[model samples]
Target chain A: MSSEGTQPLGRARPQETPAVAAPLLRRGMGNLATVAAHLVLMTWTVFVAFPFLWMVVTSFKTDQEIFFSPWRLPSALRWENFARAWTDASIGRYFLNSLIVVTGAMVLTLLCASMTAYALARFDFPGNRILYYCFLAGLMFPVFLALVPLFFVVRDLHLVGTFQGLIIVYTAYSLPFSIFFLHGFFRSLPGEVAEAAIVDGASPYRVFFDVMLPMAQPGLVAVGIFNFLGQWNQFILPLILMPNPDRYVLSQGLAFLAIQRGYESDWSALFAGLTITMLPTLIVYVFFQRRVQQGLTVGALKG
Target chain B: MHHHKYRLIIPFVLPSALIYGVFVLWPYAQALYFSLTRWRGFSRNRPFVGLDNFERMLDDRLFWNALEHNALMLVVLPSATVALSLLFSALIAQGGRGLRGAEIYRIVSFFPQVMSAVVIGVLWSFVFHPNIGVLNGFLRVIGLGSLQRTWLGDPQWVLWAIALVAVWSSVGFFMILFIAGMQSIPTDLYDAATVDGASRWRAFFGITLPLLRDHLQVAFVFMGLSALDLFALVQVMAENGGPSRAADVIARYMYDLAFNKSQFGYATAIGVVLLILSLVLSVLVVQLTQRERIEF
Candidate 1:
């Protein structure tokens, strides 16, 4: 209850200190209230995780088992469902398409966004503020607004339904956020490092690539993951631009599978396809949960 | 040095600017032009029809319905998501007691944010699938069978059902944001409140809520923007707007107009309206949230 004790908690360990104070404040609420809080948290955790768990479990169940025992665990591991989804169902093709486009877009976005961010952060130039605002303005304008004209633009370039086209669109669409997020990181970097490198006769390009880009690795990773998740999961843009089924990305392919539910098909493969579509992002998220969370929240809160 | 700095800046900035221009800015400018012309997106020849597309949009009942659906989502999604997120964040932050295992719960709750909206939509559509859906099965098992309804199929329930999915998908994110926001609040305020015999609710309303205004504002605006952009979910889950176009949102309607019906000019008008709406909301959010930052 002392000011002396609580002031330190306020300045240090912003994410951790609140936990130390919360329970004491809520002590009068007693064990039952605490238990109720736990219960609510656990229930929502289950609610959020269950659909994903269901997708994975259902992928291994036969149609009859899925229909008859919707809640029950699958009786056997049906690995073939994934096989079917991969081979016959074309989820494999879609997965490969996604891998190509997501990687291409992520790399392109990182390179360009970092370059732009570095310029805006480090250099003094005309139109710098205008260019920065131009990118930032893209944050509010939904891609749907650009869908029509963007479609025609890509079509006119003869890149429609091509990986290169989707890559360009995704890269362009993602640049706003990537540049905005990276600009902050670049601005925060000690100017002395870049200045010393430049004085050592490192060209501006070399100072950027050799010195600054590596220094901005964390920023790059955050923006990279952000653009990766976004481009991988994009549906509407691909749906419009990539009309060929052969070029369908994972999201577009999954939607295609869902819409084709009325056709005669293996329900298990469909579920497996859904699982296949979700696994890469989920696995990446599990590994880099902190970075992914930071990426998403930063884009929303700060950028 | 100054001239060199300026020259170098162009190389660094040009790639991003060019790509962004060709793809984003140019398309948007074309959207303006196309909105004025009575042109099908595919073929070139078209007469100029100034304001006609916008006029048609004003008269279109379906556009209004779709906009209304988006407005509903804009209100419901952010409120429900932020509310539940605030509660969950508070619970998870109550770490001194039995709720010590906050990390797992936090991670698990955020599991949905990592997945594609298309995947979430497909997954939830199956979860809400009529006969074999897990929701209905669980309802039946709980003997609440009569309460179960065709969630996405019925017009009355479709929007709510989609909104619920959105809330589920979104809560973890906002929860994380609020948790971060709350952590930055000094523990002294809570201590003072405790000494004053202020109840937990009172401390929350007076101390926590006011301090967290900036975070809440950001969350609301971001979530609102998302609410407007529900193309993937609506397209995948509700089958491009459920029965009677009940769950149809502006983005999906624009897609249908551009792609399905080939009403390119009209669709561009819809897109312009969508742009205007988003810009308006964003400006409003900035204006609303621009209260003097509380330094504490």
Candidate 2:
């Protein structure tokens, strides 16, 4: 207990702290509870890992192998499954579409949201509190609440079924959270830099853009990660706003392919398509997981 | 400074404010009005029918069916997710320092949460694919062939199946949350409890659980709201609520009405109902979970 946070991570190098290890193991249910904890942990690891491993293995199997040898690895790496998924199943198109929409939306969200957040944080205008809370209010209800009319609004703007339409919609909905998170961040930033820049006769916009925005880089990154993942994985907005089959985002495209699995049972290609849809998110999570957890946990605890 | 404030403020705020208003806020206000009318597709003529959609919900069988499922979710999803996460978190931080690789477990378990819900749904459909599914295949190998059933296709199992996936995808996120909470509780409290002859069970339920109430509140509200808005999963697993409408939920009912059926007014009404349910759920969690703060 005394060496609490100093527990060396990774493999138990109990040799480094033999004194610490012995009493810790001996104190609780002695060896039994540790064994039970390991059992629970192992069972969960298997549960989470099994489906993914199975999916990865199954993606390479031929239709025949998929049905007969469900447990077996594919006899060969059937790269055609990935090829068919990418080309024929239109997963490649969907992946590109998701990239465009998410990239555009994330940039727009950070730009507009950070500007708005900086205003709320740095200035004390007449309706500052009102505007701040107004933005935060979007966090309370689920985004789907506006779905029925949101379509009509998009259609009215003649932006329906386009990347710009979906991008703006994603940016709009993401505002509440981006603003909320960045507002806290911008508010907490040291005011000395901004004050110093202003006193040098720097224009207010100059102070914000050249001075303040760069200072808010850490906040921007956190918000960027949260919104990038959110906007990328967004399903309903794209499902509703971008109704054209050719322009469907990844999640919506996968659903289309899944449902279409009935008419054409290309099980391998379907699995490959699902894996394709999951790849970028997997890569992002693998690298930026610590940041992802921190940013999102703050959102969860607050929102 | 005061004279120049509005220059930065108005420009900084107005564009996003305008976009947010038109796209998000305006639609929210417009939905309430649309709900009270008989607004339909591509129509120039529309009659304002006060309370008609809401009243129709009283007699709508599908409405009740969907509401019942969501009500069931309101009860089931949060409890299952919270219980598993709490247990996992407690284990991760047990006695201040948990077993080796607890941190790694926390890290890997979170992968599913970051995956798009559509991917999870489509992936699990393969897993529940009856003959080719791993679930059934494992059952056969384990000599439990008779126990296998078409999970998503079974009316009795469909809702629970989706809920189970929902819990599985989410439990890790909450585990990380609770682990943070547990690790923050001073080790001295546990030491004090042990010295007072409190068993681990008593110490956990009494000291650990009580101290983690705020985290519990966050977990419940989030889990409850998600349960209420289980639109993505339900749409993926059972677009029209699955077999015999066994798995229909309010959010899906709303989406189906608006998108497929094009009964925009009635669908918007349903959306309003979903909104009200979520608000009530949040308020209820706050009221119910409120406790006196114990300063350490």
Candidate 3:
């Protein structure tokens, strides 16, 4: 920008009325430019959204219809593909596995992170500074680099291929960001209410649970949505740790279905499986769309 | 009384400390030791051979090939995604009042951000399918059939094709980020520029981009790290790292060595290399993109 031969912001004139001022990108008005921008945006909209739409549409078509008329609407709305994918393949089971692990991990991650964050934020104690920074450092380390030793650690603890193993590992991996974000939330709280509760003969735990916990809910929800997406969409960890066929998460199960699709050629069922995997995230994102984006962007900027 | 304070603090801090210690910290520490040993994963015959794996990796063709692919991605993904995202953000959120259909476009574009990488990889794999695939089918319909290729299967275009998908899925997320960054800048900065006869393009260069430099730097680091460790997408999209290892990356190759080939020691060496490269590259990115701070 400095090299672009333009007036710098310091040289910017005082604000003028909208009618007097030519707003950024609004001057030299051309219907052609606006139309061109809309055209390009629409093209990208299709590029991004069409794949998911086609996944849903193709799921309703029969194999012949899919192969011959890829763009045509399904000749019939055969719900059989959904049923077959759900029952015959393992999508249904994997969906439940993902649900269990992700929910379990989220609860634990929030619990440990909140308690730890509260202590680090509100107290002046020895080793607190060192411990907080230690937790924060986890955000930088690449998880896959630890894959080999991580597998061995899980195996030694007899948690090599179990749900509990995944729940704990996911929680541990989630702690750094959770603690970091929640520390800010906990620190920003007014101390008077917590002190008043403490003076009224409440223990620290009681004070935290009754007063402080409720106050930290917004931060919890933000980090909760953030961790939920990370855990649900997790792949490489489960690939190594949860090798048992029955315990496959949705991502793994979808990948398994895709590889098998090449042999079985049940393209419709594969589409159905992918569409099924997409549904829960779509619903969650739509519901908590604002919080999710805010949390993710904040995480990147802060971390 | 002094001990009583620790009584409360210890309980709160211990659980996180324990969980983080065993799972995240311990394994990372052990990886250093494991990288120097030669063993097949199961037994305890891990006799140490210091730096042998590193020596082997230095000479290994596959390691070099994979590193080259990662380097290529490191360059391509960030630049393409950033350039497209910056333009889209400006157009969509122009002067604090967007163009028509801006809301729908903003919401719809962010949809892919929520979908799992495996779903994206699987879905796009079909989109690039050669025969009845959407891409080839569209090409034929548009009378550009000669331009169609078996995108994933073709070695010449496999890496770029997959890179295109990465850019496709990620541009929206970064665009949203840029829009957020844009909103934080004082509106009068743009207004002032506009009132001074600066053209729209000139105002963007002088104001919007300079103010958005911080977000831009972070995005570059995030993208570069992703390029370094694109294991999940490549695993789901390409079979065995594509034809002749054209799409192979360091992380995927490391997975093959450890799990598939039983070369745990060698794989750990590659993983160590990956860890070092990521650390170095992120530092390099921040350093290269550094400019004189323009505090508003």
Candidate 4:
């Protein structure tokens, strides 16, 4: 980079002397730049991954090792930490609960949001634009903003502690992004096939179910995985609504274990619980990394 | 055709509409109403008290303090995330031509984005644990033992500790966003800049930043909202606002008010304030960043 001004490339273009030298200088700087860039990137990668690594390693250590030999590698696998987390710590129950709610919420949110997205994208009905914007508006309504009234709404229906209530909340919360994302997909889809289906005297519902919905499968998968990760990781709603120990989701469960066990000698068990709670989403992310990343950008960019 | 429109629209839209309305819209409207009432969490015969809650919030020190923390977050979080993201994305994008491992680095950096905030909070708490923590241990390893402090326990360090986690978790997502933005910039412009003797830094400021206005706006809005909704971190890490309410933000405070103290009405007022604050910030961000797209 420092050698740019004196390089022969600068003498070639007198009109823009500095401009002519830049490419050559950049070429020379490339090697040094790559090393520097890698240094920064590697440092950040370590910064990002080290905690997770520490969490896993710490989970394998006994209480004494964690407290005393914090930096040392565990001598044994200590798989029983996981057992303690799953059974005595109750993360297993919470994991099961999370799976049920997230699955139900994913399916229901996809169903409702996609159907609405399809309508808004395909049909020119009265209030179509209005309805689309209304769903879009849901994006701004953070869960905390409606916590008090929503608690009352759920409690009034006598579903406060029920999975059904949480599922409903998750579905509603996930709808805005789902609809917005799928709306773009539904709109971009070729209208020719769906038009032909309509011309064949197929019912509107049948056309959607049989034809357009299938065509929107990619979008569905994108939104489905997005909703799944979101619902799986949800904390605030479950924390407020599911006070019952039996019904705690993974996030709430992990938090509970952290607080309850933080003061005890059960630190490794807490780490184990954190690891278990993080596993599903981590697997999903690792497997479907591209799709997950794209889904995140799709909502932000498209909206 | 007109009749068919309504037939298809109603069925397709009703399910989502009803759920969204009942869960989101109705509660929001009810929040607006509840903000004006003197109802406790369980009371049915709530009496109307117009603007009293808002008036109380005005005089509430804890509310103001929480708001101040949130305001600090709103300022610091997005700026840090955007700056770091831009730096990382630029390196990955330009990377001095053929920088190896950009793809791997990108993937690795995004690891935290996949985990839940609760997990991040728990893991960070362990990282900041005074005796057993990696951070303090590292400080001691490097002979900087005096610098090691209780990160989340000290009221002074707690908010910064939480903000660091926020930045850590979010930097990759925004980096991905900026990478997309940077990649879309026509390479010929950079080539031209190179040919014109512009330095990499000059090209970045002159060419890259101007084109990434839209992505920056998106980042600002998203990070701002995340800042305002920072409950999981503070809750799990600091054990609800940390020492002396040093790290308390609006969302956690509202949660405590409603759930802990049963001050449903007061909490609703806080929620309303948060809602309006978020809405205002969002609109302002959009308006502030609204500029004509420079077509390449």
- For each candidate, the DockQ is 0.57, 0.50, 0.52, 0.50
Which 10 consecutive residues of model 4 chain B have the lowest summed lDDT? Answer: B287-296
Ten consecutive residues with minimal summed lDDT in candidate 3 chain A? A5-14
lDDT computed for candidate 1: 0.82
Error of 1 at A219 (Å): 0.8
Whichever of 1 and 4 has more lDDT, that candidate is 4
Query: Alpha carbon lDDT of residue A195, candidate 1?
Result: 81
Which scores higher on DockQ, 2 or 3?
3
Clashing pairs in 4: A18-B197, A19-B196, A19-B197
CA lDDT of each prediction against the hidden true structure:
0.82, 0.83, 0.84, 0.84
Q: Write the per-residue lDDT of candidate 2 for residues B2-101, one digit (tens) a residue.
A: 7688877888899899989999999998888989999888685668999999999999999999999999998999999999998887776663344777
Write the residue-wise lDDT of candidate 3 on A1-303 in tens digits: 222111122221112212222365465547777788789888899888888888899999999998999879998898999988897888999999999999999999999999999989988898999999999988888987799999989999999789999999999999999999899889989999999998898978898899999999988998999998999999989999988989999998888888887688988888888888888899898987766666676777777
Q: Can you tell me which runs of candidate 1 are displaced by over 4 Å?
A: A1-15, A18-29, B94-98, B289-296
What is candidate 4's CA lDDT for residue B242?
91
Could you give the DockQ of candidate 2?
Answer: 0.50
What residue pairs are clashing in model 1?
none
Any residue pairs clashing in model 2, and if so which?
A: none
DockQ-based CAPRI category assigned to the predicted complex of candidate 3: medium
**Of the candidates shown, which would achieve the greatest DockQ relative to the real structure?**
1
